[model samples]
Target chain A: MPITTCVFDAYGTLFDVNAAAAQAADDPDFPRLADLWPAVARDWRRKQLEYTWLRAVADRHCDFWQVTQDGLDWALAAQGLDDPALRARLLALYRQLPTYAEVPAMLAALKARGLTTAILSNGSPDMLNAAVASAGIAPQLDAILSVETVGVFKPHARVYDLVGAQFGCAKDEVLFVSSNGWDAAGAAGYGFRTIWVNRAGDPPDRLYADPHHTLGNLVSIPDLL
Target chain B: MPITTCVFDAYGTLFDVNAAAAQAADDPDFPRLADLWPAVARDWRRKQLEYTWLRAVADRHCDFWQVTQDGLDWALAAQGLDDPALRARLLALYRQLPTYAEVPAMLAALKARGLTTAILSNGSPDMLNAAVASAGIAPQLDAILSVETVGVFKPHARVYDLVGAQFGCAKDEVLFVSSNGWDAAGAAGYGFRTIWVNRAGDPPDRLYADPHHTLGNLVSIPDLL
Candidate 1:
């Protein structure tokens, strides 16, 4: 299958999830919140993925925002934080997370090549739009896809199918790029040629599906495609 | 449904994933590897969950060890640590991970209360055994269930089903506990009473499957149950 379209996962792939949390750490109201940010982000991301998968399996559906909030609440309490105002501020910042330095340029490069570019993420449509708009990268995207459409999360074949269904292509015809190793493996197993954007210098998960390519960041994606 | 039993997630839930890396940091041959351990463990865990779901969706199966190694390799490369010996030592440490201080006494309390105790983990049977044996917590478990039996990972209905299957009870009869908020939600959604062991002081995931209880750590589980 020819790869004519490129789909990216949002959170860790295009957006810096920790950026908002890191910013909030410096807030006057919550000095210790900064040290707690990464763990919060990690817990949120982990919960977000788990919610998507569980809902997918149970055939239940909810927007990513609800899941994101749930994740945040759990994280805050786990950290022994009870300040409602601080929680609210951190979450608001999350809504406007920044894009990684390489993201906009990569998206632009893909667009200049006349290839269809979109975001296939666990994020809700509104969240996706907000992120793309906030990051100033919406103009580079041809479409923004969310798992909400399929009522499932990534690594689920049905969710991946939504991307192919949208683009009018088979799964194999799309290049799925994500900073998440699992999503890369899931997309690969679903038959998409995957590129793992190893942003955090993390490892590839061997047990799932293997990526067709691994890159330091999205900066190298254009050459691979 | 009444919570007759409390099943715990291993790894980050009951074990200190960072302790091994912190210990390895003291090694002269791999000074920086220790610093990289937390990131490595995080990535590996993320991939482990990803692989379990991907394989479950794809109907592809491999043990957790393979997944662990795959995640390690990716983490190593991302951190620019290519030394074979360092990688081996780190991976070996994972098998013999130490339990959290509160684990044994908590398990004893659960057992003392005549409640069933088990481990519902993404770890393969072998890995679980090694961890249990190394931590000297093996005798405390009524059962050590792995996703290997179901050919899937946590947050999956089938993996949760294994718990009921082992105990000859309905899923709702079990009280599933995990440090991972999403897993708590998944298991809760699956009909088990759930507890979120918020060891890192993280927030609730705002899942449809909210836990029956939220705790800072396993130290208080016996009292709650």
Candidate 2:
């Protein structure tokens, strides 16, 4: 089926999840974090994704806000950093994660092509709103759907079902994009045409599902169509 | 109902997942992996659990063997190692992972106390069987259940139901032990009397389910009983 809607994952796909830690490197209170922030950010993002999946499986639903904080807690404790001020700064940066260089133009390109664009993310409404507005892409998005509505995180069929439910389209009519391999796999397995934003050049998962396209960045997404 | 079944997650609970990499360090092929093996094993283990959960959510079930290999693949590439010889050696070591020092005695203690002990794990049947026999814990275990039976990994209520269905007991009558905080939370949320091994001294997760026991090792299990 021809695609009518394009749904993107917010974190890592549109927003740079590493921006908070990268920015924290310059903070005067934790100047030494420059050496460790990269690893901390990697651990934080890993745990964040793991928490969402765990909650989905356990049937214990928490908004992405709680999971994000939980992830930051793990990251800080793992790195032996106990600065409350640093934690607050990192979280504040997370709420307004910077957009990737190509995000605005890519979303605008999709809009110019006469396609409806939305965000189907594990992010909470508040987090998504804060990010979209801060990133200055709010005017380009038709909808910002968070997993909070269904009380489950991504990769779950119900979580992806919201796209069609909100946009009034069939599952096949939505083109899904995500930097996360699992999200791409899940969306494809659910029958959406998936494009994996292979930002890290990671190998594809050996899982049953395969992404229809593996692009390096969001700017290339419009070209895929 | 009185506790009748004692189910354990096999990987980190009874077996040292790190031993495979540690042992591989002794191999003449890859001495350099010694310093990096710890982190590699950690990454491999992290990704393995992730693939299981992601597959469970995506409704794209693959056996844990493939998932294990996928995890290893990610770790290997992440560390810039591209040797097929090293990969083979690691897989061989993993197939017969060494058991934790306290595993046999702990399982025997439970059996002597008249409890039917089993392993309810995300490991495939072949993987679980090989590890059980190679680790010499097979004689003490009444059953070795794999996620293959339900075609979904743990943290899912259906996977936990295998324990009760096999033992003909209520959910509360099962005591589930896992070193993974998320698994402990999921099993506890599903009504098992969960004990988190807490091997790494990690802080408790803020998930809704709280483990009934936070013990340091399997040796402490009998004391808890």
User: lDDT winner among the candidates?
Assistant: 2
Cα error of candidate 2 at position B64, Å? 1.6
DockQ of each: 0.38, 0.59
The regions of model 2 sitting more than 4 angstroms off are A1-3, A30-35, A170-173, B1-4, B31-36, B83-85
Minimum summed lDDT over a 10-residue window in model 2 chain A is located at: A200-209
> Each model's RMSD to truth, in Å?
4.6, 2.4
- Candidate 2 is graded, for docking, as medium
Cα lDDT of model 2 by residue, A64-167, tens digit: 99989989988888888888999999999999999999889988998999999999999999999999999999989999999889888889899888988898
lDDT for each residue of candidate 1 in B1-225, tens digit (9 for 90 to 100):
666877889988888876766777789989876567777666656665665556655557688788777767766776778889987888888889999998999998888889989999989898899999999988789999988887766666788888878989877778888888778878887888888887766545676668878888788878875
lDDT of each: 0.79, 0.89
lDDT of 1 at B162: 87
The alpha-carbon lDDT assigned to residue A187 of candidate 1 equals 86
In model 1, where do residues sit more than 4 Å from their true spots?
A: A10-60, A72-114, A129-142, A179-181, A196-207, A213-225, B1-6, B12-19, B22-60, B75-80, B97-115, B133-140, B170-173, B214-225
Q: Pick the candidate with the highest TM-score.
A: 2
The pairs that clash in candidate 2 are: none
* Candidate 1 clash figure, as a count: 21
